[model samples]
Target: MTKLTSLTIAEARAKLRAKEFSALELTDAYISSIEKSRTLNAYVVETPELARARARASDAKLAKGEGGALEGIPLGIKDLFATKGVHTQACSHILDKFQPTYESTVTANLFDAGAVMLGKLNMDEFAMGSSNETSYYGPVANPWRRKNSNATLVPGGSSGGSAAAVAAHICAGATATDTGGSIRQPAALTGTVGIKPTYGRCSRWGIVAFASSLDQAGPIARDVRDAAIMLKAMASVDPKDTTSVDRPVPDYEAVLGKSIKGLRVGIPKEYRPEGLSSEIDALWNRGAQWLKEQGAEIVEISLPHTKYALPAYYIVAPAEASSNLARYDGVRYGLRVPGDDLIDTYERTRAAGFGREVQRRVLIGTYVLSAGYYDAYYVKAQKVRTLIKRDFDEAWNKVDVVLTPATPSAAFAPGEITDPVEMYLNDVFTVTVNMAGLPGIAVPAGFSEQGLPLGLQLIGKPFDEETLFQTAFAIEQAAGKFTAPQWW
Candidate 1:
């Protein structure tokens, strides 16, 4: 018999339907596993009672010979999502213990489909950092370690907790937001599959805004199939969110294992930047080869503006962050520090609440949006953003999908890269997808010389996630699943 904790969402779902195990029993197994894996610091809150209750309800539904898509499947919700009375802090001290009365659109959709909530997962404070160290809760330890070294490495961020939890088998899947490479990079580090749907594919309402234009909800799971199933349940048109797309959500699972014969997968020429590691280059080239072996054609295309994506992303994302974070002033909710005056109260509250990375980005955001510099920085970045989008649009005519390395390198030790600029470069291959509002999926391609995981990303046209999933399934079949050794 397989340990329930080791089962993928799809496996667990099938087993649940076959009466192989009760939902309560499965939930209990996960709860026990989570309790024992505390050193990873993956979850910010563990809602065992609520999870059990949901599982019980799912059991009853199953007994009646009917249930939702994810009946009894337990999932970890990111702290960035508003879970209506559960902790929704974005892992920032500023929103300390901030509970919402409403649930995020994505989470609500999952719950409505009978998915059990394990609890809120941790993340970088206000989604500002590349490493998980910026989280108020502390960094999430990657379950995977270098072969013989005992050093702990960061499970990337800002969706570190989601990625770590999924990789460690703490949850069947997890809800994560990606503003830039938050979703893909973390999944790459933790040996999990993560997908960031097209910008409006998943609603942003009540997800704790962080660069509203770039923030999109998706799922991190043990494998490509589980990710596909989770994304199907998480995506829906929401009346509350104006940005939510109105198209019917396709059954992503149905497209899996589909033939990729004759598919043109674009290998962007500009993605092979100067600083990319040789190991990563080999993994990416191997990924293209894997696809080619699956009867797909690999075409080296050029998205010339790719070099400008990182700089433009930094300016644009922080500019939006500055505007979005303004509402957190010591006014209605969250931390409030009493001061001599109103402005003092705001200053004191923010200074004590936000982490250094968050503060730094806020300052950068403010500076770009400030007088005299707004046109020079923010406005120019937006123009560059348009050009980046155009670059992708034109490439779509030449290719069915694009393949790139998810991160410049594999996971590194926490705090290993002291310079923030060096850390920002980690998104070199990923930021362009967000800038173009296209869907992208990161699947583990291979491992590094040190035995850490390396991932290859598949970027698809906007709202064309089905193609991406099909292609990812092809790669997943070739490379096979990469699971972290159970050192925890």
Candidate 2:
């Protein structure tokens, strides 16, 4: 029998339905694996009992012929999603003791589909860092490393834990959010398939806000098919979230293994900038070549305004974050610090609660949105953002899907980037898709010389995840699933 850790969601569901393995047994296997792989630091909180209870319920449902596609499969929830009766801190001190009274729409939807919840996973504080180091719980270690080397590698953030847990077989798949590369970057680092569906594809109502305009919920799994299953279950239109699209959700799994012949894949010249690594450049070329072998028409195109994407994203995301985080005033929902006066209470609480990076972003955000500087910073950045979206609009006119490197380079060591601006630049290749509210995905293409994973991103037309997944599935089949790190 294949261990629970190695089986895909579809395989597990079939076996489970046939009474080959109980949901409790599967959950136990993953819990045991998590215990054995302590060094990965993937989870911030483990809810084994809760998971077992949910699994038992699923098993009962299965007995009654009431099971869904994901029924009884263990799934990891990124700490960013609000879970009712569970602590959701966003891996930050500011909301340390915060427990939500209501479940996030995403989490509720997963449960509604019969997926068992394993636990809340770790992440960079407030989804701000490139590496997982900025997390209050400490950095998550990459499972891959050279023999006899004590060097700690990065599990990319802020969805690092989600990717790490799935890669380590702690869960069959995980729910992840990408506000400027959180899901895709970590998926690349941990060598898993992750997708950021079109902006409104998944409801964001219960997810903890980071960059509201850019944040999107998706899935990270071992294969494209598993990702599709989990994504379909999680996607629903919620009236609570104004941004959630009310359009009909597609059957993502139904179209898997479909042919990609005659599809137009655009290769943006501007993505291969001067400073990108030769190894990455080579892998990108190899990926494009592989698509050609599969009969995809690769055409070179220009997204000329791409150069301004990073700067504009920084301005827009932080501005939104500052406004979102202002609700944590130590009064209503989160931590509370007693003070001498009303103003003192707010100042002292925020200063003492938030991490340095979070504080830095808050300050920058406040400054940009301030009365005197709004026109010069915020307004100008929005215009640039519009131009960046226009660039994509022009490209999509001629192509069905756009292909590019997910990150400038593979995962770096923990704490490699001390400068905040440099850290922000890590999302250069990713943030634009979020800005345009388009769908994107990161699938493992190959590995670097040091054996770290490299990923290729596919940006699709608005709400056109079918094309994105088809393109990604083709690439994933060509690349082959990566072997798990031995240390895991």
Q: Which candidate gets the maximum TM-score versus the true structure?
A: 1
Worst window of 10 by summed lDDT in candidate 2? 143-152
- lDDT value for candidate 1? 0.92
Q: Write the per-residue lDDT of candidate 1 for residues 3-98, one digit (tens) a residue.
A: 999999999999999999999999999999999999999998999999999999999999998899999999999999999999889998888778
TM-score for each model? 0.99, 0.98
- lDDT over C-alpha atoms for residue 103 of model 1: 85
| Root-mean-square deviation of every model | 0.8, 1.2
Model 2 alpha-carbon miss at residue 39, Å:
2.3
Give one digit per residue, the lDDT tens place, for model 2 in 175-282.
999989988888888789899998888999988898887899999998888898898899999999988998888888877778888889999999989889999899
Q: Residue 390 in candidate 1 has what lDDT?
A: 95
lDDT of each: 0.92, 0.88
Error of 2 at 239 (Å): 0.9
Candidate 1 deviation (Cα RMSD): 0.8
Tell me the spans in candidate 2 whose CA falls farther than 4 Å from its real position.
146-148
